[model samples]
Target: MKNLRLERCGITQYDEIFYNLSYDELFRHETDAALPDSERGVVASSGAVAVDTGKFTGRSPKDKYVVNEETSRDKIWWGIGPVAPTTNNSDNQQISEETWYYLKDLCLKRLNGRKLYVVDGFCGTNEDSRMRIRLVTEIAWKAHFFKNMFIRPTAKELEGFVPDWTILDACKITCPEPQRHNLRTPVFVAFNMMERMTLIGGTWYGGEIKKGIFSVMNYFLPLKGMGSFHCSANMGRDGDTALFFGLSGTGKTTLSTDPKRLLIGDDEHGWDHDGIFNLEGGCYAKCIKLSPEKEPDIFKAIRRNALLENVVMDAKGVVDYSCDKKTENTRASYPIDHIERIVRPVSRGGHPSRIIFLTCDAYGVLPPVAKLTQDQAMYHFLSGYTAKVAGTELGITEPKATFSTCFGQAFLFLHPTRYANILGRKMEEHGSQAYLVNTGWIRGKYGEGERMDLASTRRIIDAILDGTLDEASFETMPIFNLQVPREIPGVDSGILNPRNVWKDKADYDKTCRKLAGMFMAHFNNFTDTEKGRALVAAGPQLDAEADAAYSSEA
Candidate 1:
């Protein structure tokens, strides 16, 4: 098998190529590049190397594309396209095979005569299911990022390392002509599944590289009948494993890195008949407004060799974690081993005993914590409901409801139902309980209500993990039909039920119905099949009488 062959990808020229450098070596090169003259990066007070992503600080979903060739054209879930533009509305936008090749040649030419840093690593920790990946980039920090984020090979393993897939990240390059290439923007993240290659340009956001591989695994794992998840997993001392599913800003990484429990993985995982395994070797945690008091595990992980992206620093190079002047998506990338508690050697665990679906409900209409039936688990999984407040996105003054199917629509390749089916079957087979925990607000919407305290949420999560909540009495919530616990050990009973804490009960009822309607409308995007209809019933309902009765009961 060929190993580290850039020539095979049609590039004959490069200044220098370094392969699998140690963290110290990469850090030396990174700091050198950040010299006074070069605007690359600097060492922060915490000893982490901090760099700015310039224009793009987050993943660009719209610019992402998949080559609609014979191998994947029929299999990909290319959802409906826009009426006027003639492109899919989904994140997996379609690009012709010809256009993909055109961009490939451009990417190759841009790397010519430029220094390249190549790193070889594994994606999944399970040797049986993991994919050997090679990342070739021009930036030393990016090479470091890939090394920190992926499972590093040992000295013996690196001898014959051949990547199952490869990513060519030309962070400093962009297409010269979007009109001629028939592209939306000069920046493009085009993937050709048949070729087992991904081409990235115009964005230095390291997440694009990390998540691009995840999309590859999402496609392949499902084909192998294994479940790929955009969630966090950890194991308790009692041998109980739990998975946390949610979108960004919703505590997936923060909550799952429990000090008491052994963290299996923080971001992504895969589940098969055997069990679940961590997909990546590291944690890419959002560190905006990060504090040691709130998140002890993640805070301490930011030490020497950790990579901080787009985080603001003062004149003396001390990091201001609360500053969002650059972007609200300030992040820190560090290997999982940085944490004090974790599953050693291999990050794999038994079938999860419980699954928690986390959502930051800015509207504050949903109960703080609610239990779900198996069907409801699949329904909520498909819905993947979460809300974004004013500052989270570009142009939001109010809380906007966002639903990314399966909590990771951006990375999914197959239909949403395919993944939902696998989850439902696995849950039924293993008897895994599901719960939805809202960490957003308490009394009212974003403007009026206070955010849920981290301590209280942790207490609620502890109850679920320790099996205390299972014995507590549950009451049905209106419209959503979620079963809320009557009382939690450390949590106030008044805040357990959302309506009880709301200042205006009638306004609460109105908001609940509006959110329910949004859920129903969003579910319409899914195909109308027998299973689809069944899962639909598991979601929220809007009945006038039910709302009135629920208001009076509160």
Candidate 2:
């Protein structure tokens, strides 16, 4: 059996062969090179990984491990060469389906029944150790998910960008067969590595290159996982549990590290039999020439173990930080392994006391923070309400409807109902609850439109933190259509009335007309769809209750 040889830390190094080779040459040798199969079929290159190929007497495909050597002093870090240019045969040069059949054998043959941690990444040794570690761990994760999946390392555009990754490692791991199982997600962490690959990623991605290629960086892992990345924290009441859900922009890292609460995990997380745990060692923040003032936490965290993303630089190559270039994907990705007290492999061991579903609402209608009920949680969860990402020159330009479970859609394999069922059951079982805090806006009276102040939102969150809202009396108020509380702390109870938050009484009527029209379009008018009809039916009753709750008694 071939064992992974590690050298003493800081003492050993690979032969440095990757340094001399041109990117083009390496791609040529790997992708263009061919091997013969016993079935008289020709195949593209095979994995250059070191393994015990002899132990595999198995005949099926399954989950396997692709090791990312971050701490091994003895392991060799092989640098990757540039991608070979697509030629007359680019499309013709796909890896044979049978290749996956072989890949399945490789992964299962190697890591079956062995508790392992597979790191995922782009190209391990293409540039520096920072980049390598990120890419490796990402690869490990992807490899772990798809037993027979063969990952090709490249940052070039093929299909799209993959972000549905978690430094989510396993505990009692076992790979039975890499048999043909339909994988819906990609093990995405690199630039378009999952581009051509459909399942685990998306089609739109970053254009600017980091280091050299747009591979995933190792610095994204939180330090808690015990790696060498940065820019993360672990905060909550006991520091044992916390919520880690957010959109691409709205300060996921910023708020998660509030000095008040201990940080949990970022990027990738898994709900296991025990609890939830993070897979990586650091953090990955989006930066396009970021400055300390704009992102001070991340700025400070980018030290020895950090890998800067597609950041634009000045003549001196220093980051500008203020520039918002839609053209560039200035990013800062790290591994959770960098954090010191990271919660590992967060299993769905139990329900969370508080489940905060974050949003980046551009319409800004609701308050930044308002508590929601369990049913409301489910409602909003199904609503998957989020504004369309402001489309870029290359993407959509307006806010659109995006509803996803918890808030991620990239790598989810199961139907959203699966997560919903889990959350509902767990919340009920644990007596923990769900809340819908509209971190979006406030509708004032008459034509005077008003936006909720962020400070007030913070205060609201603060109140939630101290349990002041819970102690206060809550009377369920209703919106005309939805069962929203008329009075939520840090929120105006008037929105319960259709007339509130509009420019004029006329506007209120117009708005209701619009909402009803939208509803009718979606089958709200049908009595046959009782479930759908019930939603609208719950409207007025919910509004009255909410109004009573908000009509505070001094």
Instruction: Choose the strongest candidate by lDDT.
Output: 1
Q: Let me know the TM-score candidate 2 reaches against the reference structure.
A: 0.52
Cα lDDT of all candidates, in order?
0.87, 0.35
Candidate 1 global lDDT = 0.87
What lDDT does candidate 1 reach at residue 98? Answer: 88
Q: What tens digits encode model 1's per-residue C-alpha lDDT throughout 304-394?
A: 9799999889888889999999999999999989988999878989999999999999999999899999989999999999998767456
Model 1, residue 51: distance off in Å is: 1.6
Candidate 1: segments with Cα more than 4 A from true spot = 1-3, 33-39, 79-89, 391-398, 544-548, 551-554
Q: Please count the clashing residue pairs in each candidate, in the order shown.
A: 0, 131
State the local distance difference test value for candidate 2. 0.35
